[model samples]
Each structure stands twice: as structure tokens, then as C-alpha cells.
Target: MTTSALSAPPLHSSAHDDNVPNGEDQAQRAAELAALHRAADAGEEAAAWVRQLAGRQGEEEHGRLLERVAEAIVKASSREIIPGSDGLLTEELRYTLAADVVLGASHTTGTLPELHPGERMPLIAVCSIAATLPSCVLGDLVREVEVLAAEMEAATDAGRAAELPAAG
Candidate 1:
């Protein structure tokens, strides 16, 4: 009788069909995830392009656009996330501000206009979160944003190169 430790049966049998190749499902899933990531990345680029165009128009216009976008995000998540339970600006509201409120003069405006109930919560939340960010973290965040911008730029260049006709 031959003794071999390598002959041990697998601890669990695969639920998939026997003829189906291994890693095919995982490869498909990976491709799907990559597609989703690419779509999201393209969306971010589109938003930044819009922001840049707005900024080119004027500071006031850009600021207003930022405020509107932030407002939309906050309003969308109001009932489920913000709830207005702890006054108007809750922690959740602050987090939304962090992600959505990049451009604007709302931070400079110290006094907030009186808002009825849920109104202006987004603006208030934005200014509050902007004011709360530590200087060091803000610096780091700016650096990271720059890095991401460079990466996106490189990716765009690579894609354009791929699309161009080969020289004779």
C-alpha cells in the first residue's frame, strides 16, 4: 500500500457544475467590478469637468453650483440619514458635507440665514464641515486630490493614445 498525504480529499465540494472551469465565475465578477469602477471614475471626471466649466464662468456661479449639488445630496438623504433629529446639522450631515461641498464662499459667510425646519440644512452643514476640517488633514486631502487628478489625466492620455490611428 502506498502512503501519500497529497491524496487527502478536499474539505468541501464545489457547488458549481463539474464541467464549468474554475476561476471563470471569479473572472467574470472581477470584470464586472472593473466596469463599475470605470463607470464611476468616468462619472467623477464628468462632474469635475462641470465644476471646472462653472468655475471658469465666475466664483459666484461656481459657489452657487457647489451649494446646489451639496443641497441635492443632503436633501436626497434627509429622512434616512440626517433626520434633523439633533438640530439641523447632524454628524451624518457633516459627512455628506465633506464629500459634496468642495467649492463655494459659504465657508466665508459666518452668519447663516434663518431656515425653516429642513431648509438650508445643506448649506449650513457644508459650512460647518468645512470649518471643522483640521488644517493638516486639509493639506493631506488636497495632496491626495492632486494625485488622483494626475492619475486620471494619465489614464485619459493612455485611452486617447489607444484610440488614435497608427502613423504610416
Candidate 2:
């Protein structure tokens, strides 16, 4: 019974009839959870990356965002929407912005312009929403939405990663 073995991080051990051959369940469980915690903490780093990218949207971007928010609000509260209703206004903005970010990141911009509403109007509509929201809320909202987009991309990447085989 060496001290190093006792103090060492436990290996992946479990009584699931899969990996564990002989080990204390307590140590196994603790190690599994610790690994999970580390992954969770790594996610915070991913979130920070998102926030940093979002925060750099710049003044011209903010102004454009504010104008979009305003127009979006008016169109949303309007009695008669010509082609699209304001009912899904906010969601549309989030989705469209997310889509734009995705497309821009992937460099597939000219392929698709609309993320929601099934049309190319979201780009036009989002600029409307940014115009409607208050100044303080607008930039934060932009950050929030951009962060959401990045999260979406991260999730997709994670999903793709999950399907990969374990390291040798």
C-alpha cells in the first residue's frame, strides 16, 4: 500500500460491469465526478471566449444593433405586420444573429441569409430589433446573443467530438 497509490487520482473505475475489475466504488465515483467538474470548468473558459468575442463588436456595431432593436420593437408591437408578425420578433433576432455569426465564422455567408422565418428577411428584421431595445440593453443583448451563437457552435463541435473514438 504505497502513499502515492492512495493519494493518486483514481482511475476510471465503476461497478457497471464494463470497466471496473476490482476497486472501491467511493474512489471511482469521486474520480468520475472530479473529471466531470473539470469539464464543466472548461466550459466556463469556452463561455469567456464567447464573451470576449461578443464584447469586441465595436461602436458602429452597437449603433447598428440599437437601430435594429428599435425597428424590431415597433414592428413587433404593430397592429398589422405586412409579411411577418412581431410575435416571434426577439427569437428571430437571436436566431438570425446566431446564424449570421455561424455563417460568418464558417465563411458560408452568401449561401444562406435567413436563420428563422424561413426567409431572407431576418437580416433586415434583426437590425430592426437592435434599434428598438434601449442603449444599455442593446450591447449586452448583442453580447448575450453572440455568446448564445458561440455556445451553439461549441455544442455542435462537442457533439461531433462525442462521436469520436476514445484516445489510444
Candidate 3:
């Protein structure tokens, strides 16, 4: 691809008037997406990796959890698209939500127990995957965060509480 297709010069990045996707960034984003997909879907192998990453488990269940979380995240992300407004992009993108969930929430408060020979290691590669990318994919990422926030909540008022249902 031509250089022009890759970037609009650094000066233009602040100007969102153009709706075109950056070729270079797109390529990078694609690769990042693939890596996240792999990291999440590696299943038990991922679990063991998470344990080591979290300092919770050993090397045995890494692949397993990796696969589960990655696969789940992908499924969750790919399921929806935030209806664009006036045909312009915004923070409703999954990438944004993902980055917040994995990097912000999981990294902050997800360390837990039972990584012996077989256990869940507070795996959040999918979240990390989302967290690492740009904020363009937030709609997909939001679902994950919402789910996690729901799970981590204690009693009725702790953690990120779920939104109340809309009134008719």
C-alpha cells in the first residue's frame, strides 16, 4: 500500500473529519486482534500462562484458561456493533471497552487463588487484548466489562454495579 494510505501525517491525527481508516494502523490493529484472539483461545495453555502472569497458578493450566477467556471475549466482542450516529465513529467501539476492562479492571483487582495443578487463574487475556488496542472497538468491549463488573460485585452496592433496566 502507498504511504498516503498508511497515514495522514501526524498533524492530521487530531482531526477526525476524515472517516477513513489508516492503512498502517488497520494492519497493526488486525495483527493486534489476531494476537488477542490467540492469547484468549489457547484454553488450558492460557490458564497456566495466566497463573504465571497473575503469580497465581503454575504452567499446567495456562493453555486451557487462555483458550476459554480468549474464545469468550472474541465471541462477546463479535456479537454486536454500536449503531453509528450521523455516520461518525465514537467511543462505543469495542476496543475502548476492552482496554478499560482488561487493563483497567482486571489488572487492578483480579488476582485470585487455586493455581496449583488445576485451577482458574483470574484469566483476563481477552480483557488485556481489548485493553491493548485503540478505543475504536468499545461496543464489543463494553459487554465484557459489564459482565465482569456484574460478576465482581459483592452484596448489592460493591464493585461496578450493573445498570438498572430502562423504564418503559
Looking at model 2, residue 63 earns an lDDT score of 33
- lDDT of each residue in 1-168, candidate 1, tens digit only: 875765654456776747443578657546544433433343344334333333443446444555454343323222222211322434554554454344334455542222223323333333342323222123333343234334443543443344356789
For 1-168, candidate 3 gives per-residue lDDT tens digits of 557835445644544656555677678557545533432333223333433434433332433343444443443333321223232223343343243322323343454333332222133333443333222244443344334333322211211122233358
C-alpha local distance difference test of each model: 0.39, 0.36, 0.36
* Candidates' RMSD to native: 16.9, 18.4, 15.5
At residue 149, give the lDDT of candidate 2.
Answer: 34
lDDT of 1: 0.39
Candidate 2 on 58-108: residue-level lDDT in tens?
Answer: 443433333443333333323211112232335665443342442332342
The TM-score ranking, best first, is: 1, 2, 3
- Deviation (Å) of 118 in candidate 2: 30
